[model samples]
Target: MAFTVKINNLSKELTLFLNWLFSIDIQANMPGKSRTFRCKTVKFWSIWPLPPKVEEVHDVVYLDGIYLARNLCVLICCNDTHVLGWYVCRYEHAKALFNVKTMDQAFIWINELSAWRMTYSDFLREMTVDEFENKCFTHERLLKAESSIWRMIRQQTLFTFLEYIDITVPTTNNRIEGGVNAQLRSMLRAHRGLTLERRLKAVY
Candidate 1:
């Protein structure tokens, strides 16, 4: 059996914070092993002309007898090690960056590159619905507009110029859609006791 920590006046807030950090999952809790948590607690100083001894301070924070366990069934896949797609995207980003001259243009190009990467990352992994809607969707639209401009540039048959630069064909945002489906499944499973705090807590 797993032991539950007591949530009293002093510990109630900390308990809630930890729960938020771990998020939620419905499964059996079995006592595995006990461990201690040690961290440095710090204090702030206002000005430079303060006492040297009191200027910088630190305290030790400790937690004892915490049980930790691993769930064999809750395995998740990671594709970040799959480097070919990312290398291609990076090549394209470098090409775009080289073509742009102004600082503002460079910044926007970088934004699109980052967004493009995020789009692919979400596709390979699972993400929340909000991430799908906000990050992936926004990037897809931007890339579509950019694709048109690139098409016009390529039509000039500047073979030698094109050879020096890399190109990435923009793909559909299907990964973003899949993320939304995963989020929906999470929501449906935890739908019985629907409250604002509970929903937000479960999602975050």
Candidate 2:
């Protein structure tokens, strides 16, 4: 009977811990320690929360990145309501372009354009008067030829969403931005003492 009671108490404590961990608004109202279990909030935080395994793929998903620090960012994937997955990295990259054949072609084209721009700039620096006159007409053309990798990636992202037009996917990821990301920022601000690892765990 005593052992059964202990088990029940432990289970209750575990439930409370999980509730505190995930609850943003509740945390603001709770005390630093669990009154019933006599456990400090730090003890609960010490146990790292694992990200839930996501096997089902949503037809329409939203992707966004939120910066935690100067060099650190978290990329989030979500459907209409729930966050499916997240990745922590130093820099943001276009996930839509990964493992596609067109990615290589786009990079190659951008690289060739960049190389040509560099060559043109160097030529202009050492050109003779007659050479300068010949190339002067091309200066405006060179300016117009400038390419941006981000611009290309943005176009691809838009095209992917356009392909899913028959479905009810939102044109913007405002749900994730206003709901999940906003809550996360608020929670982080409340618990500013968390280390990088713990901060990520909190996010997970």
Candidate 3:
């Protein structure tokens, strides 16, 4: 067993703030047997003074649309992985949401489960609606422990992306992601301790 040294409230908050800067996932309830999390938590955001998060690097990029991007949420992917799929995110809400432990696992699992999807534009084909439902349900049941959010995603959004891939449609919704966040930070740099609404509005 391990233990954290006793600290005052302010000290603890500062420790967590440091964790978020380096993309370390910490749980108040669990000690460090893990480096990642099974779900999104409040511990991931930056406090003032720290620079914005540095997103994970990928072979390519994507977005979920303007509103989603502006809200500090975006979906990102690459052709080498999904071949036009939505997978990565700014904060990896997908991984945490899906309860997948790491990018390596996510890539393998997504590719294995979704590989049956057709990849050619000239010959568009789809699993029958009945077949799709059955497969999703089967996978969902099999991987239920993996992530409830992932199961929900499989049942709801998987087929939609599959159809788009079959027709060679690009999966990315073009929009500024980290760039938007950077611009907001720069704009707010000179300001000090503004109210939440005012600060956010400036960010927006």
Candidate 4:
């Protein structure tokens, strides 16, 4: 048992199989513990296994928009405009977009950036080719920066809060995030020398 203190080391395949087994077990139980699996299953699974696949596809997808908005606020507050000039004259806009006060406002601002009609694409098209070329280095870099979030929004249900007005995400709360961080630290402290692969098994 990789989770047991008696075990000195765990192979990658064992970690993958265990993570998958636990995930399936958790899903089936739905907010409660499932019957503990048998050791015999582990022996059987270890012989021939499905290839381990790690997909971070929708991992913390909403956090992308949150992080981007926070970073924009940081850049706006900075004195050096040369570093982030596109946001230079847009301090108020940036503040409103970041909207730390209200979750709904923050969600709206992120959507505005990648919205169909007033999309980032429209921002590019409005500029003369020469001006666009001039802004290529800085502006294009900024554009490319959030391209992934926009892409994710298109594919995922990032706007679920629209239907459920009462939903509050964890990142917005320092208390919950700190508690999670502290738990992680305690885990690492108690189990010194835990590899990233093993740590990720707990996450999976």
Candidate 5:
């Protein structure tokens, strides 16, 4: 009986290890059936790798949200090289991570400029050569005039990175958006059989 119990324990450990390998394969963009066949295991087991804790502060951070479902989105935070962390929340709540004061100021500017009753295109058309060349029509000022149209340009941090001429910061979060989030979406698409809980685990 003791020998039989030892064999059962060994089998359980092997199963757990295979499940972890299965998760790794899935994350590496392997399809469900393909990975299961490669691992020589059934597709019932699922495991999620725990991300290492990040304590160091980065010079520049980029934030973007990727929608997993109609109402659910994962807010991804990353620097140029590595993903810092992510928060899963409703699509509307994703804006909570943004600088509230800056957003409020943008809204105020939009309201003030709305009284002009001019379209963004019209404003551009009427710009003088000096105003355009002298940077009087800066993105911040011009974009504020049409906040509804240039929603992202109003963010304070969007161009603040440019102020630090000494540091190298990317103008766009394309790395996270294109590299990380895009891969995640593709992985989810490949593993459509995952339940909601498993999907969340896979995302984590």
Candidate 6:
């Protein structure tokens, strides 16, 4: 329901459950990484349930929550960086280590960042250590940032696509409109012998 809308006929409850399950599976599969299962499962819990005083008693109640957050963040960052490294690495053997995420939609974000002067540390600052090490553990925050990055990637891809086609994605197309009008006028003069009704039908 969250990703597909209501088209899938899945309820919000079901969607939330599935999303939680997927996160669990993703964390479970990561290797060479350590995550506190308490944090992992707590990371999947509803954000609204977290009281404002969570910071005071966090150690007492949310040990697993902290681990969950850190694990999810590692995966997200690693997966994203892996995708980026693919397009950048030229070595045939090194290229094998890069994943497909860098070759497709997500690559646009990675490539744009690569060309720009912004450092990975700069991007990490936007996430903030607290956000990265903790906030990324939650489903809601993760999905929000994921969507934001994806949109940036998509916009860059469209701009590149327009450039390749040699057609400016104009803010306004008055020039195109005038060109179409000129074509119709010239065509009409050449076929003035035809009735207006026939001209309209032919144009259509």
Who wins the lDDT comparison? 2
Per-model TM-score, in order, reads: 0.20, 0.53, 0.26, 0.26, 0.47, 0.17
**RMSD versus native structure for model 5:** 15.3
Better model by TM-score: candidate 1 vs candidate 6? 1
Give the CA lDDT, 0 to 100, for residue 195 in model 1. Answer: 50
TM-score (C-alpha, index-matched) for candidate 3: 0.26
66-173: candidate 6 lDDT, tens digit per residue: 011222211100111111111111121313222433346445546654554244434443533463466432244534654685686667652344234443334433
Q: Write the per-residue lDDT of candidate 5 for residues 102-194, one digit (tens) a residue.
A: 545555655644654464555554544463465344344545534654454555544344456688656567888888888788777767777
Off by over 4 Å in 2: 1-5, 18-43, 95-169
Q: What are the per-residue Cα lDDT tens digits for candidate 1 across 59-95?
A: 2111111011121111111122211110001111224
How are the candidates ranked when ordered by TM-score, highest leading? Answer: 2, 5, 4, 3, 1, 6
In candidate 4, which residue ranges exceed 4 Å CA deviation?
1-145, 152-156, 166-178, 186-204
On the 0 to 100 scale, the lDDT of residue 171 in model 4 is 49
State the displacement of the C-alpha of residue 172, model 2, in Å, after optimal TM-score superposition.
1.6
- The candidate with the higher TM-score, 1 or 2, is 2
Which one is best on TM-score?
A: 2
Compute the lDDT of residue 26 as modeled in candidate 2.
Answer: 48
Q: lDDT by residue for model 4 over 10-105, one digit each (tens)?
A: 464456445544442332342223222333224533242222343333212211111112222111111111111112121223344344345566
lDDT digits (tens) for residues 1-204 of candidate 3: 999997555555555434433332334333332243212323423332222343555533443322233444323333333323332223443333244445565556576545423343223222334644552233433244345646755675433333333344433333334454344454445443445544543333
Mark the regions of model 3 whose C-alpha exceeds 4 Å error after superposition: 1-92, 96-155, 166-175
Each candidate: how many clashes?
0, 0, 0, 0, 0, 7
Please say which candidate is ahead in TM-score: 2 or 6: 2
Query: What TM-score quantifies how close candidate 4 is to the native fold?
Result: 0.26
